[model samples]
Target chain A: MKKGKWGLIIFGLVIFIVGVTFPVWYGAGTSAPAPVLDMDTPVIKSMPNKKCVEDTAFIRAHHMKLLDAWRDEAVRDGHREYTAKDGRRFEKSLTGTCLQCHSNKSAFCDRCHNYVGAKPSCFSCHIVPEEVKK
Target chain B: MKLLLPIIALFVVALLAACFAWAEAVSLLTILAYTSFLIFAAGFVYRMMKWAKSPVPFRIPTTCGQEKSLPWIKTHPLENPANAWGAIGRMAGEILLFRSLFRNADVKMIGGRPVYGSAKWLWFFGLMFHGSLLLVALRHLRFFTEPILPFVNGLSALDGFFEIGVPALYLSDAALLAGLTFLFFRRVVLPQVRYISLFTDYFALLLIAAIAMTGLLMRHVYPVDLSAVKTMVAGWLVFAPVVPANAGVMLYLHLGFVFVLLAWLPWSKLIHMGGIFLSPTRNLINNNRSVRHLNPWNPAVKVHTYEEYEDEFRDKMKAAGLPVEKE
Candidate 1:
């Protein structure tokens, strides 16, 4: 009962220090060059307009939310027409539009997801098409 | 009269959160959220380490049982633990069940007769308050996790089993409010309790109540964009934080109250959260008679040796016919 808690002190410090570096160390597993996320993935570069439904910066910051909102609107609320700022219209479905060009999820989505060690749940329910597999 | 300052303090904090929300101070909120977590965890760990610094130089566990000596006499393992394992069991019981508080009783003169009964309501409400608060925290993990665990989903589902509204009302929310109300009122209604209640005690109750109320209002009345909230949380997880452009005022208020709670935890009586685990009385085994306890703080002092005493006493001993070693 009177003994020093050196075990507890060491344990607490280990958990705290290791936990602090978990996100960075978890994703940075290999020294190999990470794949680039770009518009020139052979599909988007071939399109007439190399633009998404939103501005480039906005899309980068809010693509996940946009996708989530689209899911609720299309699947839950049953309203699907999503108008892009440039007067183009598209169905508010992830698999229908967003994944069409970014069909190579392993390349584009996983590149960022794996790099950040973020496990986005989109692939939990959505499947890769027969022709889309790398 | 004393409660005025804390009340104003609570109002000011609530106002700040609302302001942050309306202004869409996303980056500030992000910074505040992470800073709050770091302060809470670090402060708690620091306090725990501080407790470890003091040496409890005696086996002075609070015991209410016969000592473990005579073979024929029965020993209460829990009340007076003879060893470490028994001490662990006692600590676990106290921590998990609030065993001492459960035994609380208050006598009242009813019809010129002293009445004695279980303070079941006090125990029940206290249990409800802490239990519901824990469950509510667990339910919020949905906003933090990507493929949020099944247990979190299941906990929220169980909490909202009544399904009373658009967002599905949670039983924990209601229980938390009711329990807080009871505790707050008890402090005000009972003269003895009210007399002893400091401003901080009332402030703690009101603060948590406000948090629960504002949280419920956000979920049920003026809802924030939850998907946006989750996205921000996910970004925070990956060290790629982005403040949401449209996260509303209620979220800010709820978060602000949480910030205050985190900052106050290490300094508040609420630190019993960690203290319960470290409490010597509750955690130590009662084995003073069986084992010798040494005080590390007690240092050896210069002393006159028996031989020295005899050497000095030799002249007197020769006159008084006393035995002397030096003589």
Candidate 2:
């Protein structure tokens, strides 16, 4: 008995396999080592608490939300002060507050952002600090 | 109730994942993912091969319009394709745009008389659901890709173009939920559909809904470390699987549900995804009139020819005074 349309059948099967198992082939030899974030900035070293506005885990997961909220509050509503969980007050400014300690943008922000391919438009309007230009 | 069973089963599955996640059994989850994927892939291939090997010895294309014939006659190329390319185009239209489903009709009472009217809701929601699912699946390429593909990035940008909410909600996610809601409610609300629905129907829907809900929980309600998620996915893709130290309970639940769906897909009605392509009625070209196709099921038999019959029965026919063709 003749097999039904072997050419079309094989083509369809190949497409299905290639499409479903795309990740395996695409990342076959790729090594996505986690980006090593640097916390050795002069401002970070001089900090008393040596902590961010939130805990490490919270910041790691939701720093984008915090930054977005800060942008809205500071620029739109004129509320520049953020009250942390521990009653510590922080100025809700990315460049002035967050970037002061993480001044080395390439080392601090760019690492994880590049690792995950997140191209946030923070630097579109705001300039990278001149101090950390080199 | 039939509805209650799938919901309860899904809940139990979720609870199982939650317990495992609570115990930090990430390796077990990884193993399950790998095993489920292997089963899904192998089963899918086996099923497709079975379909491929089945002999369809007839040009049984479901023609809906005038077939190609006499020079003066008009023919619908898509509805009744005469050539391979036309058939392919028809398949593309059916697969991508659901051309046939778009022509769905419903019977309803109008002024005490039965009337046939267009019922495009299933087509609409089905397209929405499948389209969004495709996009959502494509969006996950970022997790597996070391350097994310530009097309995936562009797709993500388009999906999250609205920039609503923190973390930027993907429009596909919302559309997927809306589609699922409409589809689920249609089964529950329409008595005709509800009567025909079975356990697997509700199970498939609920399982997907659970996956989506758990994913949303992780994204908005309880944000997980995305970098870790990406790392874990990348690790799996590269064959050096690393269980994230803190993949969170929601991640496991979401991923566990997905693995379950994958494992169940080939063995369930979801195989229609592959079956649609192989369906003879849809894929075959209506060219039986133009070309001869021998049915393979027809068996060859030993034949007694007229000459042989005449030769054998000539003596008997001559003796009985009946006319014989030959001596």
Each predicted complex: what DockQ?
0.07, 0.65
Measured by lDDT, the strongest candidate is: 2
Worst ten-residue run, lDDT, model 1 chain B?
B141-150
Candidate 1 stretches with Cα past 4 Å from truth are: A9-134, B109-117, B303-327
Model 1: residue B274 alpha-carbon error in angstroms: 0.9
Tens digits of per-residue lDDT, candidate 1, B1-327, equal 756778999999988888877777777888887888788778877888888777777866888877688899999888888888888888877877777778788788999999987786788899889999999987776665545556777787688887565456889999999999999999889899889999889899999998898899877766665555666666677677767645567778888998899888877888788778778887787878777877767889899999988888878888999877665
lDDT string, candidate 2, B70-151, tens digits: 9899999999999889899999999999988999999989999999999999999999999998998898788878788989
DockQ, 0 to 1 scale, candidate 2: 0.65
Runs off by more than 4 Å, candidate 2: A1-4, A75-77, A131-134, B307-327
Where is model 2 chain B poorest over a 10-residue stretch in terms of lDDT? Answer: B239-248
What is the docking quality class of candidate 2? Answer: medium
